[model samples]
Target: MGNLSRKKKKNKKEKQKEKTKNNLIDLQMDQENEKIQKTIKIITLGTGESGKSTFLKQLSILYSTGFEESSRELYASTIQKNLIHYIKILLRAAHSLGIKMQEENIRLSRSFFAFDDLTTQSLQAIIQLWSDPGLKEAYERRSEFQLPDMSKYFLDDAERIGKSDYLPTDQDILNCRIPTTGVNELNIVVDDLPWVVVDVGGQRSERRKWIHHFDGVTLVVYVVALSEYDQRLFEDQTVNRMLESLDLFAKTINNECFENKNCVVLFNKDDIFRKKIKEIPLKTCFPNFTGENDYQSTCKFIQEKFDKIGRNKKRVIFYHFTCATDTESMRAVFDVVSSTILQNQLNVGGYL
Candidate 1:
């Protein structure tokens, strides 16, 4: 009888211990949920190919577990599509330049160029045409026409993409050009703070959809390609790309919906700009300016151009020169951005 009483007391003590442990776990989970609820939403805004997606990829690589297998497969498909697009661009350039091709090559290029839909057979035809020596000659002469900056990258991979098994590497995926169609969001935990980074399409057609996302945005990261000063948009050749970016920046900051939002202006593609600026002067793009053809002067001039837009605004604008593909540089920049956002959040007495 005494032994039975002792067993009952021990069981009760074990039950109480279990209950206390469970309560602690529940409390911890509640606190974690609260932290998640207080997440910050950051929207990335930029012109097409201004490294928005690349920036997101860097975040995933550094913070998250990286993309899943399915996403990597999707990126592979994009690489194949990029190959086809590259071939089409080359064919169009050749046609526009009145560059004559061999009879067979011309026939293939014309058929592929005219096709509205691409099928397995059409893809095979593209592979064949891409392999021809005549097409190679045309590609070699691509400098005569205004090809995309990414054209050569895709062209070099055209043959590899036609293989039965082709997987895209992280670098290839980063370099691949797939225009964002709509709003894409990536959730990440940075410095124990839940962060939702949103990427939207940057084309003129895509701007209309941006209004819906401005309701609760905490910050805006606006990216512009510094090397685009001498280029024109692919959709509208008449519009100078740099001028278009400036106009877009002006409109974005001046928008009433985002008046209270803090902005980070990223002068992206600095690597390309550093190389190109030496060959092409800033005066070529902005005639009134008479700055030295060095990197610092040119970048300062561009920053001032953007700063002029925000002179009358009440919000704070932070500027960063970035090469989005460079992981180390982006990491440092993102750290600064994280600190700025946290400080702003505290100053505003809540999340912005």
Candidate 2:
């Protein structure tokens, strides 16, 4: 009887100990997980067609934001690719059957990943505000989310603010401007992962304003348009100014700039550039960079020249990209960006 009683107690003790160990493990796991939430805050920055939106959507769905789980957006790249493949088949099938098609209109959106809704409103309202002629010109010169001329825009509001004839419309954005501004930070993230995203990824020249919002970030993606290589837009002299911005961006954010972690390149319109190269004569980052050394017949040659000399200068591992990139190509490039997060973080802020 004594022996049986002892064995029962021993078994009970063992079971209790097992339960305690399991509980401890669960607690430890909960703590370990928050490390990712606290340590990393990824931000997206790029020019258009570089796939920032698609990639961001992927991330959002993967992580399962606004849904109780990991990204309720419910997407798998391969599945999406397959669906698109079938859609292409359908499109072709319809075309063969003498079916006419209508143009599909698209809408765009970005997030700020912040606490208040101000970031979202800031992006949307500022875009609306910049519609003013003079403000738009200033924004083109310096791409920022700064408030527009309230005097010109909110003439009545200025009067309500106890100020009459305030031609210097916005007192807020003007206040933020400072002389010692070699570096700018436009950090718009929340909980180190960004709950919202309000990005201005188009217009390579305006990419300069990117640094203005870089105080806090965990990841960055740069999108250089290969389409710009194949198709030249010479009517408005916008390309020249854009080239200037690219050169300056390259100069400031050197190779050593991004500590090699959480940064990647989306070479947009890569396929299109290949098909459209005839239109683009100058393939270099800056066409009028006035380099007596480098030639600009092709992108490969330009990258090669920059590679040899860019070694002494800022390195351009910037991938070639296209929104219309094939499945195989996107797979390769997407992996490249994902792996970059494992490298070192880039210098996402300041002039350099």
Candidate 3:
């Protein structure tokens, strides 16, 4: 009787929590539909490495539900890998600081950047570009950095003071807008609020473009990786750079016009943080950590951040998802977006 009662109580509490969550969703939906047939556009604004691509991929799959696993696998193995490699080398060059690629390290290092997704890149944002495979980093193309003992030194560690393939130190800071489609799953009614997904590239110059594509973005999904926190300890400026970029993007928009724009700051992976549950709520582990449970935590944190900044945080909502394209992750990308659309009713009117 005691065990049954405790289980029943726990379940009862959980049910109550769920009821509250449903109420919030219904409220948001009602407000969203105040102006009937509102055409909500979902612009997926995010940076190159922020998992916007992955989210879109998931969304695509969800909308195209019932696709054969083989077809999805083929897609992931081909176009996805190509696109990923293209992005990785660009960074390896910058951070390697002109290190010559050791034949051995070249293959291994290349593998790390190969998978190329938000979670992977967030943990180690590809910082440098790789050199030609056969040639050593000390191999000359205008030849300034030459280490004497090739065996003693790691080829990648050599100085890149005068490398020819420099992307230049004077690149402009403009966020790149990656326009994507394949959102066949959700209804037009669900996506009523116009969405402009801004993909803020990590490099400073790349963030400038994020503002150009916000035609009618109603929500912002902040994809923070648990792995990134472990790697950077929030000490690295990578997270701040991302946040600052968002802040700047916000500044570009006319506050009066986009005032109702909702922000859903999603904490992407709880599966990665099983060990740190006691330290603090996964959402609040950093400076402005929020509470637990993906949806409520996200909404609370968004609300709190906006309140702190004197903006209408009430309009913002949040959620966490442990989504991956693989089979075992047991979660789908489109499902997250679908739930988000349902709960936030992002297309709802300017004001309830």
Candidate 4:
């Protein structure tokens, strides 16, 4: 009888161990399932230089540990590339406006076209062109042409960027403009929920690829440069940039695939707009706008222009005036956006 009792005790202990092991497995599986369920997919849409990439960079900076050392190094090369790009833009603008370049400046422009890649020496040559009185005059008339807002930024930093050991600071990298050629994605956990933020090229050529990403998106963050109200597209000078953005926003919201998705319309570049609003009338592009020259009234009028696009749509549209480079401001806006998304999701699930 003693031996039988001892055997029973051993079996009971083994059974308890197996039960705990199974429970742990079940717990881990539940955790994995929860992660998958909580994953939110967000896609950013806008015209080129509309702050889509900037917004993603802001997210990575605020939420993640910030960019890695290697990524910062990459921007050094990007900054150089941006200088070359800016020069090309200036050359094109000069050619279009029939502005004559000095012989030296002409030679410098030809040298850039000569090399497929930019060497340090070649970049220095470009920087020299910036000091040319003729080139400076042409750049002054850049507004007549469709140059990017960051043209001055790149031109101003040319000499530093031409150095062999120059490194881009966080702010430099943020302000540096690079046209996205394809879809770029960042996976970040914001407010404890996993998020996959997608940024695509915002140029007209890039718009065709956007439809491919529309299916699984949880939210669409549409960025429009508020300052672009006075600008024209680089690709097509005839079409106003702000009008193009308005049309794109309308098409995105009206799409059946994203009819249920939420949208956040960011009228970015509030800082630039604040500086130019008084000088450049809102009615310049939007003739129907009758608002005052103040920032509040101007932004309200701009918001209404965008709002009118989605008036018939069922999807909720939220508008914000944002300066994408401002981390503190963006952080606050992102918090509100995330909260709205969460609440809306819960309401959809009958949890609110």
Top candidate, metric TM-score? 4
lDDT of 1 by residue, 125-181 (tens): 776777776666666554344555666666666666656577777667767767899
Q: Each candidate: how many clashes? A: 0, 38, 50, 0
The Cα error of candidate 4 at residue 124, in Å, is 4.8
Among these predictions, the greatest lDDT belongs to 4
State candidate 2's TM-score. Answer: 0.39
**Which should have the higher lDDT, number 2 or number 3?**
3
Per-residue lDDT value at 129 in model 4: 75
The parts of candidate 4 lying over 4 Å away from their true place are 1-34, 91-128, 132-137, 350-352
Off by over 4 Å in 1: 1-37, 98-147, 311-313, 350-352
Q: Looking at model 3, how many pairs of residues clash?
A: 50
Give the per-residue lDDT digits (tens) of candidate 3, residues 118-223: 2334223222333444233332221122111111122242232112231211000001113233222233323333332234443344546555545555555545
Global lDDT of model 2:
0.39
TM-score of each: 0.76, 0.39, 0.41, 0.80
